[model samples]
Target: MKSTLNKTDEVNGTIVIELEKADYQENVDKSLNQFRQRANIPGFRQGKVPKSLIQKLYGKAVKADEINKIVTDEVGNFIRDNKLKILGEPLPDNSDEKLVDLENDEILKFYFDVALTPEFDLPLDKSVELTCHKVLLEENLLDEQMDAYKKNYGTYLSVEDEAKDTDLIKGTLTELSDSEDKDNLQVIENAILMPSYIKDEEIKSSFTGSKAGDKVVFNPKKAYDNNEAEIASLLQTTKDKVKNIDSDFSLEIKEVTRYQEAEMNQELFDRVLGEGVVTTEEEFRTRIKSELEKQFKPNADHLFIHEARDIIVEKMKEVKFPDEFLKRWLLETGENRTSEQVEDDYPKILEDLKFHIAKQKIAEENNISVEFADIEALAAEVAKAQFAQYGMTNLPADVLQNYTKSMLEKEETVQNLYDKATEDKIIDWLKENVTVIEKEISSKEFNDLMNERTRLQEEN
Candidate 1:
């Protein structure tokens, strides 16, 4: 067997592998012998087929199979031996068709097109500065959050007074105009309406003083601020028909409901935080601050990563890629869409791929590793947060373990955890070793910057 690579350009190369009869004759013979042992033929007992008969029947197939195996092995070996970081799997060169005749040749020659990875370096030591915002929780923000919490745990009570803007009113909605042509003027019973949605200033004001059993006639469309769906729902009509029908409807109030806010005490804090976690208001506030900080850390880290990527890209602008070779390689890969489509997305793809390779190299240099335990712990944390979102704060140990195990068992979830763990390790290494200048910015400003960055990314 003989193998050689011809470099056509910086990124493009052709690897030719030549296999003589000696390279595959042994495997061919072995395959024929194995076939003979398993052959079933007329006039022959089982496992007693003659070698000559087996060769006549299966020689061509055995030879072809052996050649294919040899070719695949040699291709892989050539790549490894050359230490080539390829973009994708090698494709059979168009020129390979003329190189060898499978019917008569004792030697097989295979040609493949290769795309080499572009060489690049990290720009970590470059003078690049990025602001990392430490979000300071304001008193107003806490109070607003506390109010939301109180409302979430609030008590709903039935009242005899008229519905106010903050009140929920239960009424029987009836349509006055009933014509065979106006099927949309059908009435609905036991519909609940929030007074906040009522549009007419006079009608909204009138609702505050009227008691139960009072019949109020108002335009459904106007009352619901011209919300066609809401009007249709109140008048029992489809949205399309609601526009054609007259908007007048009668609302017979049956009940009025009001909500009383929950008292913030030790019990509330215990339920929000872990049981026995906070015994005082100060402790509760501190816990809230801690939670806010914990949440802010990832956002801050993301901003830093973004700034670092910009810095790296700016410094490494001189690094060049063999775009033509890459485009050809993508066309041959047969994974994504057409080459034109891939080329359209190539800029971002190339940037991400380059950064990923750089990070991997940095990780290797620093001997940074993400442990299986770290991944498992991250998975568990994710599972805990998902449970917490559903108000399941105190999950049993067995239940939590089962949920985490199930999450880790999913192929996508496992890959996500692996990626997160690897990225975290890489980022930690970068933060510790790289010259990062930390500048403070307000939370609102940081959020605006993040939103702007996201908008630009989406546009790209």
Candidate 2:
């Protein structure tokens, strides 16, 4: 067998594989004998089936299969031996019209088309300048975060006085009707209500200064502006059922519960930052500032990387790709994707592909590699960020490690983590090589900058 690559252009090529009968005749004969041993004929025993009969029956199919295997192996070997940087898998040349005639031909030829990656020069040095925004943690921002912690660690108290807008009011809700007969009306016992959620002003005012044992009559549908989900929850029924009821409901108030914010004391600190983590308010504030910085680091890194990508991509404006071949390859490989859809998304796909190629080239030049430990560490950081979203910021190291371990057990999760870890390493390398100007800005300014960038991206 002989396999050779003919370059049609810089980024496109065709590999022709010529095979002789000797290459697959032995495998074909061996398969025929196996089939002969397994055959059950009418006039002959299984092992005694005639070789000629077996050859005639399965020869073409066996020969085609053997030739296909040989072609695939040869193509793979040729690509590896030549160190070709191919874009996608090689496809059968759609323009090639030659058909394999296993019964008549002793030598067969096959054509496969390959798209090679275009090579370009990447200028990676201090010449590339990027701005890194350092978001300043203002005093007011710290106070706001402290207030959130206070609210999260607050206590609920049952009050016996007026029902405030923010108070949780427990009552028995009974539907009122004009008819003297009230037996068929819906009644939800122990129904919880929040006066603040009432959409209608007059209906909400009726609950003002409402104390225990007071009965307030109002239309549930009208009070919430006919919100199906809210009415359903208050009436303890489905949204469909809530639509049928439009009568006034009498709520016999049982108790009013108010959420009281925790005082800025040692106990509050312990609850927010874990046991004995901070003893005084000064220490607590200092620790909170540190935690905020840690939380903001990822965001800052993301912004830096985003800007770095644009800078690097702008420098690579002259890079090229095998556009026509890739379009055909995409149309063939994509599941149930139409040409119109591929055309619509191809530009974005091409841009992403270019960035990917650039990143790979950078990694190759720097000898940057990701290990299991790198992935594990990034996974742990991810786990911490997830838990921090729910105010569980100070989770134990062992707990975070276990969560990360559980996440890495899934193959898809490991792959995703690996990709993220690799990108992070690349970003670090860029930060070291490129000229990064760090500017400390207020949180609001930083947010506005990010929002402006996002708006510009969306417009583009």
Candidate 3:
């Protein structure tokens, strides 16, 4: 057997593999012997069939199987021996014919088109500056977040006074119309509504000072913005009948519900801060600030990656790609996709591929590696978050262990965790090697910068 690579350029090549009969005859002979031992025929007992008989019955099949095994092994070995920085996988050379006479042919030739990755050096130095945005937690923003927390944890109280915009009114709705026919008349009873929906300002104003026995009149459909079905249900009538009925209706307020603000005391603090984590209000506020900072770390990290990518793009030039070879390779390998569709996405794919290769090179230069333990740790954090999402905040030790084990056991879950760890490691390497310029900017400015960066990346 002879294997050779013909290089057309730095980023394009062809791998040619020529196999002789001797390359697979030994394996073919072994397979035939095994088949002979297992062969069952009319005249021969099991394990006693003649080799010639077995060959006559299954020679073609055995030969084909042996050739397949040889191809698989030789292809992998050839790629490894040549140290090919391949993109995706090798595509079969389109010019090669598929038909081959295994019985008569002494040599079988297989051709494949290979896309080689262009070699590039890492340009990591003080020359490349990446801006890192530091998010500062303002007091007003913290207060707003606190207000939201209070609202979420607020208690509902049954009030005996008039319904207000913030108050929920419980009452029965009755639909009335000019039609005297009892079947034609529509009525909806026992419906709850908020007085804020009333279109008539005077009627809505009346609801603010009115008590439970007071009644307010307004058009149900008009008040609810043409919500006929909702009006029908509220007025105890069919949706079709609601259109025929008078749009106006009277709401008799039976009860008023008000929300009571939660007290920001020890109990609230304990609930949010894991029981005695912060003893005093000052300490609690400080902890909240710290937590906000930590939460913003991921956003900052994302921006850092964007900036690093831009710096790399700016510093590095002359990225050579075998576009014609890659496009052909993509068209050939993508089974269900058309060449036109592949071509449409080729630019974005090439950019992403270049960035990935560049980052990989950077990681290699910095000796960055993600260990198995790091992946396991990340998997556990993901599992914990998933459990927390299902309202299981305080999971038992055994249950947490079991959950993490089961999560890591999943093929896709483990792969996702591994990829995340690898990205993190690469990002860390970039942060260390590249010069980062810290910038203080408003959240809005930060968002704009990110959007502009994304636009630039997409445009390329």
Candidate 4:
């Protein structure tokens, strides 16, 4: 057997592998013998089947299998031995596969196309300048966040005064009836109503400024604009049960509940940030400011990446790839993807591939790694974010650890954690090594800049 590579350029090449019958004859013979021993024909006993019959029956298949295994092993070994820096995997030349004739051919030849990664040193050292925006914790922003916390910790209280539109009115719903049947006068005891939800101005006005114990009579269908779902929810019944009935209901306001915002005290801090985390209002405000800054770091990092990508891609434009070979490989590997689709998506794919290559090079050169501890930490951050979405900002350490551990048990979750950690490490490294010009900007300005960048990207 003889194998050699022919290079067309630094980033593209082909390899030709020539093999004689000796390459696979021994393996083919051994396979045929094994088949003969396992054979159980009608006229022959097991282990006594003739080699000639076995060879005639399964000769081509066994030979093909052996040759294929030999070719795969040879190619893999050659790549490793040569320390080749390849991009996509080596593809079979001209076709996806070949069927060789062992009966007539004394020798066989195969061709495989290979691509090498284009080499370019990125200008990503201390000379590279990037701007990292620090969002100012403006007074209004802090006040807005404080309001959300107050609402979350607010208490419901009964109101003896006039009914307000936003207030919750709890009362008894008594269905009025014109007929003699008492059963038809359906009364849902302890039913709650929020008059603000009434669509009709005339019906909603009747409940305004109404004190407790005041009885209000209104047609449900007309108040709700004939929406059975809203009427059924207000009446505490299924939509199907009230789809056709249109009648007036008497609501005797039993109670008016109003939400009272929690005061900025030790109790509020304890509830939001866990017990004893902050005992004073000043400390609570400071902590909130720190958290806001931490949350905004990802956004700032995103903006920096977006700003740096164009510069780096332009710098590395001279680096090339084996475009023809890659297009063929992509079409072959993709699931039901057409040539036209590949053509249209290739430019974006190439840009992303270039960005990834640059990032990977930096990570590899700096010995950046994502350890189990890093992944666990990232999983905890993710778990905390998930809880925050449902109004849970604080959790016990044991409970949070257990939840994150459960998340890491899944393959996909662990992989995502790994990716996130690696990216964070890379961002940190870039911030440290590159010239980062710290900029203080209001939240509005930061958001407008991001929106403008997005618009420009979409335009391009």
Best by lDDT: 2
The per-residue C-alpha lDDT of model 2 at residue 333 equals 98
Q: In terms of TM-score, which candidate is strongest?
A: 4
**lDDT values for all models:** 0.76, 0.87, 0.75, 0.84
* TM-score of each candidate structure, all chains considered together: 0.68, 0.74, 0.69, 0.81
Please give the lDDT score for candidate 2: 0.87
Taking all chains together, the TM-score of candidate 2 against the true structure is 0.74
lDDT of 2 by residue, 80-112 (tens): 999989998899975536766667777788888
Q: What residue runs in model 1 are displaced by over 4 Å at the alpha carbon?
A: 2-14, 32-58, 77-83, 96-98, 151-262, 387-396, 437-447
Where does model 4 exceed 4 Å of error? 1-9, 16-58, 77-83, 95-103, 118-124, 178-180, 183-185, 244-248, 314-324, 327-351, 386-392, 395-416
Q: What does candidate 1's lDDT look like per residue over 1-460, in tens digits?
A: 9999888877778889998888889999999999988888999997899899998999988988899898998999999998887776787766645466767887777888787766766656435455556776667766766776677767878888656788877788877774566665556788777766778887787677666888888777667777889876666658997786665678888888888777788777876776898889888778776565455566788877777677666666677666776667666665867967887878887777667667677777778887879889998888876765554556678998998899888899888898888777877767776666676655567778779989998998
414-452 per-residue lDDT for model 3 (tens digits): 888887888878777666766878878665566677688
| Consecutive 10-residue window with the lowest summed lDDT within model 4 | 94-103
In candidate 4, residue 24 scores what lDDT?
80
Best of the two (2, 3) by lDDT: 2
Q: What is the lDDT of residue 86 in candidate 3?
A: 88
Ranking by TM-score: 4, 2, 3, 1
